[model samples]
Target chain A: MPAVTVRDLTRRFGPFLAVDHVSFDVEQGEIFGFLGSNGAGKSTTIRMLCGLLKPSSGTATVGGIDVGRDPEGVKRRIGYMSQRFSLYELLTVEENITFFGGLYGLDDRTLAERRAFALDMAGLKGRERTLTRDLAGGWRQRLALGCAILHEPRILFLDEPTGGVDPVSRRQFWLLINRLSESGVTVFVTTHYLDEAEHCHRLALMHSGRIAALGTVSELKNVFAKRAVVEVRTASPMEAVRALDDLPSVEKTSLFGTALHVWLRPGQRATEPLRERLDGLGIHAESLEFVQPSLEDVFMDVVERAGGTAA
Target chain B: MRRLLFLIRKEFQELRRNPRMFPVIFVAPVVQLAILGYAATTDVKNVPIVVVDADRSPVSRDLIGKFEGSPYFSVVDVTSNDGDVQREIESRRAWMALTIPPGYGDAIRNRRPVTVQIVADGSDSNSAGVGLAYASSLIAEKAAEIALQRRPPGAPTIGSIEARIRVWFNPQLLSQHFMVPGVLALLLMVITTVLGAMSVVREKELGTLEQLNVTPLKRWELTVGKLLPFGVIGIIDVLLVVAVAVLWFEIPLRGSFPLLFGLSLVYLLCTLGLGLFVSTISQSQQQAMMTAVFFFMFPMIYLSGFIFPIENMPAPIRPFTYLIPLRYYLVIVRGIFLKGVGLEAFWKDALLMLGWGVGVLMLATFRSKKTLG
Candidate 1:
């Protein structure tokens, strides 16, 4: 059974379609990754599912609860952490958790249990008495993640949860998400970090107003059908981009500082002939390591194809 | 009901958790009360003035001595030339200058009509008027005394001809005594209204309020929760200000303390409710503060019979003054403190405050819901 289901969900701010015909589903206890370009309707969709916003049209059900018919129950079943930091900065970690617990309608006994569980999970047991403002960014993010799931909510919605956290904290936050998913909590999250999508059980790439691609990491790479990513380091970055734009089997190309990452067609072997071609032009390219297409490459391929994917 | 409890509990937690803002919430009103109550006064005495007595005669000297003898005037400078008097008035060294022409004393002794030029600064009308009246009344009393001394025996005295006027309630008309009680009412408003005005705006800025809203908390629960903490602070501020009034200003609280507290609690509900109402509409704390200042500060101070005498206002404005809560509060405070009158004269004030409380609270709750919606 699906833990979350959204159908033909349309949300608008006046005439601007924030989320247009957005539809998706989260399998029970699955880590569903919602991917989108900025302003591509990810948070708007999450808000509708969580009952924070009433959709302009269509329907949503979370944990078998309808967003339209049973908003209050939907609120009780799901937890939301907004893109902007939402914890009480002035309150200490323990107090913040307890306050949220109270709002979630957990009894005092359950509240204590959840507090202890959350504190231990976040690895901030002794620092529970510390005010959230006093905590560093990483700890605060971890604490916020802890607070979001303290009620053991059936489904958790994280809106760009790791936008500004250090990489190490992001790792810990994902670890907690994985733990919760294993414990039967459905995790629906939106993030701009392409690499983070690799950790997701499945990814949905939304662009313009709808999902352009939806599949597992391997499936997404397969959909892109790219054999490998090869770095072309040349004297001039733009020269490589100009050279690769017309290159055969060049699935997608983007600049990373002075290096060029080329996405070649699937099963197209990386041969010395490519270097020979560059050498003939006197390009004197640096190391060309044939790497597998990461979610970054896959995301680019999907977003680029989004222009043509509407049909 | 359960969600309301949750919201209320959350509000209380936020209020407690924010240790830094706690002082602003609880202590600021008391401090403002203490400072404003003491500094805000209407009594005018010892107005410094330069006396330019050009007439170098015994009567001119005696008239200047009489001014120095009066408590209302402290003759700072005794100048002989007319230009010196202008200089004194120009420099603000004297709010007023009394000029006696060269022939003034000669004319008074010869029974010729004498004129003494009395000039006063008109900048600050209240204290200026007070000073002018005090000085002029004293001189008129002296004029009457002289007239009596010169009157033929068995003739009717002007004092007997004019009935003696008595001022009730405030006999001496000590501005401090009158203003201090009004100051207490004003202080209560500052605490209660400001607290309410900041509450919703704080929640919006803080983001915790969004959390509460997403929960199952009903509108009434949210309203009550947001109001309770500030309401408590308002009551505490009332007690603190009244204590200062009773002790420091010696302004008696002859009315029942419990009555004042109970009424203040109702008044605070309206005030704090208004604060929440302001918060709901305002996008930021700065806007909320400014809006509260403009709306509450002026009305409470000017229209509330706080700084001005309500009865003395124009007849049209007089009816409008009846709508200001402070008018009723002043009556209640004075009736209790000065007149030692209790509920007999105050039940009307109590009902007015109660109606305002319920009416404002309902509007606030409805508006808060609409804003969120």
Candidate 2:
């Protein structure tokens, strides 16, 4: 049985369909990334799954407990860290962890032990007595995550968990998430960072409240069937783009900065022929490079396939 | 239940950390009580006066002397004419005038009654009342003195009709005796609502309410968790006010301490629940405070029988006052403190307060659940 199952879940705020008939299931210990633009039902879906919101219609079960029927029971079985740091700013780090632990109804001894464990996991153990507000933004995010996981629930939901953190902190946060996932806790996360999406074992890309695509990293790259894009650096890139537009091998050409990105057919790589053509115009190849599709490319390809609503 | 205990501990720690709130919560009430205690009083004396003795006679001079001798009136001015006295009153420089007609001392020798007229500015009715008390007493004393001195041997005198008044509860009838209880009632309303509303609003602002919303702690548990600590602070405020009333103002407390405490707890529910209710509706802390002030302050004071008797309010307004919880609370507090009344006199008020407290808390708790919906 799946650790989390959502079927035909629909949410609406008045006429706007926030999560329109989206459904997915999370396997235990899977790192499931939910990718969407801001306001694209990512946090809303997380909130519903976490039992923080009542669904407008449809049903979800987390750890075999119906979320809508007994939300508090569902809450007990799941851990959630929202994008905004929810730990009390005025309280010390130890106080926030101990407080959240006690809130989950943990016994005193267990709460103490778990507090120490979480603080160590978040790398916030020694700063236990420091006020959360006094910490930097990255530390506060770690503290919030620490508080959420203190109870060791079977499943965890992180909503854009590393939103404004620096790249280094973001990498560190994801590393911690991977360690937790290894311990057999199902991790469901949402983020705008396509790079972060690359780290997930599987991901669901949503747009305007509907799932645009759902697949593993390799599957998404496979489905991103756009041809190899060659960057031709030239002084007049738009002129180069226009010159390359009518090439027999070229599918589409657009200028990016001072380089012309030429999407050629699958059989037509950025081969000697394309380079010879660009050299024919006064635009030298300078340094030509063929690019592999990134998760960002997959995201953009899927978003474009779904009508580019994210832009 | 355990979650609620942790929340309360967290709340206390937060309160201690924010040093700014210390002066506002602890020191403000004590200082206000002392200052308001001095400014407010039921005892009235020294009403401003500009007396014009038009008739420059010995009898008139003697009457003016009698007026000045009275403690209730301070002779701020001896004006030249009635016109001058009117100008003084209109300018708000004086609040009273004593006028004596042209009379000779022989009018009293012949046993002919002479009348002296005392006029007062009625713009300030309390001052007017005090002024009236002084003038009437002066007349009564002089009339009795004359009646006794020139009485035919064995005739009845005017002194036989004297009446001695005994003011119970507050024997001195100090306004603080009345204002202090009302201040406490208002204080509870202000602090409890602010604390309750602020707790929830801060969670919403900091995005923490959503964090706790999924926790094992239930809605009702969260409700009490947010409110109980502030309720404790409110009770502490009540104790402070009681000390100020009983010790500083010398207001008599005739009822049991347990009764006061029990009533305070009941009233706290209404106030604390009101704060929570506002917090649920408000999107921010500023909105919560504005809502509390706009909706709660005046009605809590006016309808609570604090400034004016609730019964004496207009017939249309009387029924609406029952909805104001402070009205019932004031009755319980005043009845306990002043009248020394037991459950026999105060059970209905106590029950009304309890009902309001429970009703508001339940409504607020349900509203919190609906936010998710």
Candidate 3:
């Protein structure tokens, strides 16, 4: 059975539907990524799965226990780390770890063993007495993750756990996540970083309280984006994009820094015809080549199709 | 149970780390009790009086001397002119002004009732009333003595009633004995309610509460754990303030110590529940503090009959006093402190407080569960 099975799960905040008929499954030991912009119902869905929120309708079963019927049972078997660093800022690192460990009902002997393990996991082995607020942002995030998993839960739900950390720290945190996944722990996480989606074994892209895409990175890039992505580096990429916008062959236009990436309609070539059209518009192009659609391209197309802004 | 112990330990660790908690938990109650204990007195003494004697007779000097001899009245100024007495009263130099209207010894010798015109400043009505009562009683005694001395040895007494005013419980009527205990209750209410509410809402603001919500901890465990440390601190505060009341302020602990301490525990639990209720409704620490003050603490203090007597309150609002936990607490504390009353006298208050404390805790726990969801 899948580690997490959510079928037609829905949550409404008053009249506003925060999670609308959301459905997905996380296979055991796989790193599953839930991707969405802010307020796209990622946190709400994670909350429901973590047994912290009751779904308005449908079913969510974590570790074969019905979350709606037995939320406490699901709670005992999983670990959760939120976007906000929720450790006690005034408490020392060891105190936060011990407190959470005790909450998870770890015995003293087991807790002592895990305390050392958690410290090593967060790269905070010798800094046990340092107050949480005095630690750097990256260290705090890692320590929070360490606290969440101190009980050695079978499944982990991380909701934007590296939201505001530096890129280097984020990379290190992902490496930690990879190690956990390799150790046969199902890792379910949410993020806004499209690049980070590459680290997940599979991903679900959410929009407006609905999942728009669910597949591996390459599968999402292929299935949702059927058109060819052609990058054009021109003297004026904005003018190049404007010139290409009205073309019947060009399906979508997105400006990527100094280069303009244009999605050509299916069966259209990205060779002489596109270049000749741009050159005729007085838009001088430096180079034009067909490139594999980035996950950002897939996300933009998915969001645009869902009536949200592409970029 | 173990999880609760851990959570409570965490709470104390946080409180200990905060330097500001020392003054609020340990020092503030003692200082407040000491200050409000002195200021909240109803017993008035040493009222200044201005006397204008127009007669200058031996009888008039004898009456003025009697007023001077009493501890309640101090003859601050003596003048022959009535205008000086009026000026002394108008300028607030004297609390009361007495004018003898050219009274000759012949009025007393003839056994006629002579009225002495006295004006008392009514700005502070409480002190003014006490001062007037003292002056009237002293004058009545002196007049009665003179009347008896003039009467023949065989004549029957005119006044048939000879009543003795015996003030029981507090014969000396020291307001400190009553007020100091009441101040202890007031200090406990403010500190526990406001501080407890702030601590819970602070966790919400910091997002730590949400983290705990996802854990396996039960709702009651979290609620009781969150408030248990503050409850312990509140008990310590009660001990500290009561020590100051009994030892420092010299307010005797008349009744059973265990009864007072036990009732105080029940009262503190109710206040902590009130704080939790305030926090459950508020979204921030600042909002919680404000609600704890204006909504919980102020109404509880006023309706609890801490400063104002419940019987003296308006009839329509009198029934609401039964709903205030501090109302029962004040009765219990005052009964134990001054009246030296045992459990039989205040068992009803203890029962009501017990019911109110449990009801409030259950309601707060229900609301907190909803908020966590």
Q: Of the candidates shown, which would achieve the greatest lDDT relative to the real structure?
A: 3
lDDT of 1 by residue, B282-361 (tens): 88889988988897677767977777777777887777766667778788877777777888888988788778778878
In model 3, which runs have C-alpha deviations exceeding 4 angstroms? A224-226, B84-86, B104-106, B152-160, B370-373
lDDT by residue (tens digit), candidate 1, A1-311: 79988899898898999888878888988999988778888888887787777888999899998887777788777777876668888778887888778777788899899999879887899988898888888888777777877777888989899988999989888888898889888899999888788889998988877888898889988764536778877787686677666767666678754778876767777646567667767777877877666776666667667653221
Off by over 4 Å in 1: A226-237, A247-252, A256-259, A263-273, A287-291, A308-311, B1-27, B49-65, B77-84, B97-117, B150-160, B310-331, B339-352, B369-373
Candidate 3 lDDT, A13-116, residue by residue in tens: 99999999988999999999999889999999999998889999999999999999988898899999998989999899999999999999999999999999
lDDT score of residue A164 within candidate 3: 87
The sequence of per-residue lDDT tens digits that candidate 3 reaches over residues B77-186 is 88889888768888888999888868656687677878787789999888889999899888888887897897888998897576799998888988988788889889
For candidate 3, the per-residue lDDT at A229 reads 81
Estimated TM-score per prediction? 0.88, 0.94, 0.96
Which of the numbered candidates is closest to the native, going by highest DockQ?
A: 2
- In angstroms, how far off is A310's CA in candidate 2? 2.9
- Weakest 10 consecutive residues, lDDT, candidate 1 chain B? B364-373
Candidates 1 and 2 compared: the better one by lDDT is 2
The C-alpha interface RMSD of every prediction is 3.2, 1.7, 1.9
How far does residue A112 in candidate 2 sit from its true spot (Å)? 2.9
